[model samples]
Target: MLTERWRETLVDTYGTPPIGLVSGQGATLTDEKGNSYIDLLAGIAVNALGYGNEHVAQAVYHQAQNLVHTSNLFATQPVLDAGAKLIERVGDVNARVFFCNSGAEANEAAFKLARLTGRRRILAAKHGFHGRTMGSLALTGQPDKQNAFRPLPGGVEFYPFGDADYLRQLVELNPEDTAAIIFEPIQGETGVIPAPDGFMQKVNDLCEEYGILLIVDEVQTGVGRTGTFFAHEIEGVRPDVITMAKGLGAGVPIGATITRGRARDLFTPGTHGTTFGGNPVACAAANVVLDTVDAEFLAEVTRKGDYLRQKLENLPNVDHVRGRGLMLGVVLNAPVAKQAVRGGLEKGLILNAPKENVLRLTPPLIISQHELDTALNTLRTILEELA
Candidate 1:
């Protein structure tokens, strides 16, 4: 079996595979046994347009045929197009991009940029998830993840998320020397926790007053997953830097760090680079994602999310639903979220449990109404059975 094969051959970081996905179409995935399931997690929010996206397939094919890699020395049209698309969505006239291989790499780039500010301290939100690399891991506020990798890159501080007063106190300790504050607009990994209203505006003011770079980690919430091109756009604050990955390449491996104004100019030549950072194939897919998840598409995501949230609110075991767009966390009346995931799997639905009581649903942004209804019906059965 694929699970046994993985246990024999692969590292244990993710443990054994629960299911082996051979192919996918629309929001449905087929396992090794040819059993199909409605894919709700979307590879943990990576697949924006869902499976069998024709435009991405064609773009990737075309680019792969002509060119795939140019290292950091040369450039390809697809990579250039990808960069342009990111800036177009970022809406920052002076924004510059550094492409990498994953969300962690993008956060790594942001970490290095903070170091270039010549400051000793950086602040991040508690329970925020930013990649697992040494630098990004340090910026991550979770102690459980950091404890195993002792002596991580130092000088990072953690602040309670959404507590603007606590953040102000931390910054006021030595505002001039504070380099950057990295945070997620919505903490996706811990739970789909949105920043409190007006919190971002206060953070923006503090950053501006102290000349500290504002780094918004959009790794999970970017590329129209949250009904906007970027989740931070809802708060009306312009971050000096933004890191994105998950949905940008429509399931391909790609990470991007977009820097604006002064932060934009920090990465000079010989500073930071990657070999597979801007592969033409990956860029090609990104170009398609950017072109597709536009105004009309995003509007539909908003409507679909509202519908899903309302439906979940009336579900039997669901205490509440919190999130924007397709990124939702179903807080359960009981600590049966993990059981719900297993139940979903058994009943032809793919789901995730980021917390014991929180069932996270990050289905493909393009999942159809019929697909949603089917998944919800199955989920209703799952909850009732648990009850």
Candidate 2:
């Protein structure tokens, strides 16, 4: 079986899956056993347009046929278009985009930019996840993920996720030494926790007052996942830097570390580069996703998110819902989220448990109301049985 083969050949970084998914369409997936599932995880919020997207496939196919890669030595039209589109969405003509392969790389670029400011100190949030890469891992405040890889790149200080007063105290401890303040608008890895209300505005104000750069990590919350082009946009706070991935390229791997104002000028040519970053094929796919997830499309996403949240909140075992838009976490009254995942899978649903009591739902941005209703009915049954 494929699972057996995976166990024998592959490293145990990610434990083998119980079953193999053969294919998918829209928000539904088919497993090797010929069973179908309503995909609510959406590849951890990567497939914004859902599976079997003809437009993304065609864009990738045509771009691959013409030019797949040219490294950083040459420019590609798709790369330029993707960057311009991101900047346009950011509404900052001065913002510059640095493309990379995944969310980790994006945060690494942001880390490097902070270092370039000549101040060694950086502030991050506890229980917040950025990525697993070395620099990003250091920025991530979760000790469990960092303990294994001890003695990570230092100079990062972590404050509790939504404690603005503590954050302010940390900044005042040595404001001159602080280069940047980095955080996720919504913390997804630790059960989809969001920053407290007024936090974004506070972060922006601190950065402005202290001459520090504000870096917002939107890797899991961007690309219309939060019913906004960027989650931080809702607070009307424009950070000096924003990093995003996941849904940026549909299923294609693409990460962007975007910078505005002076922060945009930090990397001068040889300072940073990626071989496969912004490849035409990936950029072309991103272009399709960007064009498809416009204002109108995102409005629909908002409506669906509210609908799903209402259903989840009313579930028998559900405690509440956290995060926002399509990037939601259903908090259960019991710590049986792992078991709930198994139940969901057995009942033709693909669910994710980021915490013992939380089920993270980041379905495709294009998932329809009918799909949501069907999935909710199944989920209700699963929760009832568990209860």
Candidate 3:
């Protein structure tokens, strides 16, 4: 089977697979052995419309038949339309879109945009996961993942997440040297932690006062994953720059860096470039994802998120519930996140542990109430048994 061949041929980065997934529809995936599991991770928050969505599939097919790629040398309709739609939804008149292939690349583009202003330093929050590429890796805050690649791009500083006063001090300390402050609205890799109340607004104010660009990394929280199109919309503070990917193209790979006001003009024609960035198929898929996640759908996401949070809080071993909308983290009393994940898998559910003590849940926005209840029941039973 291809699974066996993969073990022998593939790189060791992702390790071995637990099961051979054959097909998926909505929030359910069936393994090769015909065992079905309810997907709670949503491919790490990338499948905004779930799997095999009709609109997304149709868009991809139609675009594939029309035009797939023309490179950045020429503009394509799908790419142009997608960019316009994004800027409109973001509600920033000065915003311009730069398309790329993944979350890391979008961030890499953001770093370059910040550097183009001729500033050397960028400030990011601790426990953040930007990406593995050199530029984004420099901004990433995890020491364990970065130690192997020592001497990353210099002039990157880490502040404690959601500490406005500390951030103010850092800005005051290096006002001239600092170019930008980049952070995730909800820290995805560090257990889906949301910025504390009034934290983002304070940071925005400080960035403006100090002349430092604000970059919000919404890779995991964008495209209706967090109940809003962008997580920063909830705070009502528009960032000078924003990076997006993950669910941008549903399951298709795509990323974008959106710059606002004067920052949009920083990149010259040849200063930055990418191949296969705004391919017709990917952009088409993304447009479908955006159209599918309209205002009504977002309201449903909020309702489901509240229901899920309430259910999680009532579970026997759950200590706390965190995050907004569909992007949620279940904090366990003990460091049993891995155990709970394994238990859930055994009971025909799919979940993930982003950190040692937090079970992260990013189910599809379109997940029905019945499916959600089923997954919750299975989780409740597992948690009770563990307790």
Where does model 2 exceed 4 Å of error?
none
Give per-residue CA lDDT, model 1, range 1-387, as digits (tens): 889899999889997878888999999999999999999999999999999999999988888888878887886888898898888877876899999999999999999999999998999999999989999999988899999998999889999999999999999999888999989999999989999999988999899988999999999999888999999899798999999999999999999999997698999999999999988899899989988988999999999999999999998988999999999999999999999999888999999999999999999999999999999999999999987
Q: List CA RMSD, all candidates.
A: 0.8, 0.8, 1.0
Whole-model alpha-carbon lDDT for candidate 3: 0.91
TM-score of structure candidate 1:
0.99
Between which residue pairs do clashes occur in model 1? none
Write one digit per residue (lDDT tens) for candidate 2, span 1-387: 778888999999999998888999999999888999999999999999999999999999998898889988888899999999999999988888999999999999999999999999999998889999999999999998999998999899989888888899999999999999999999999999888899999989999999999999999999999999899999999899999999999999999999997598999978998889998999999999989988899899999999899888999899899889999999999999999899988999999999999999999998978889999999999999989
TM per candidate comes to 0.99, 0.99, 0.98
Across 1-387, the per-residue lDDT of candidate 3 in tens digits comes to: 557877999998998777789899989998888899999999999988888798898899988888888998888889989999999998876689999999999999989988988888899999999999998999999999899998999889999999999988988887998899999999989999999989999999888887788999999999988888899989898798899999999999999999996478999988999989998899999888877789998999999999999989999988899999999999999888888888987999999998778999999888988899999999998888888
Candidate 1 wrongly placed segments (more than 4 Å): none
lDDT values, one for every candidate: 0.93, 0.93, 0.91
Q: Give me the displacement of residue 336 in model 2, in angstroms.
A: 0.8
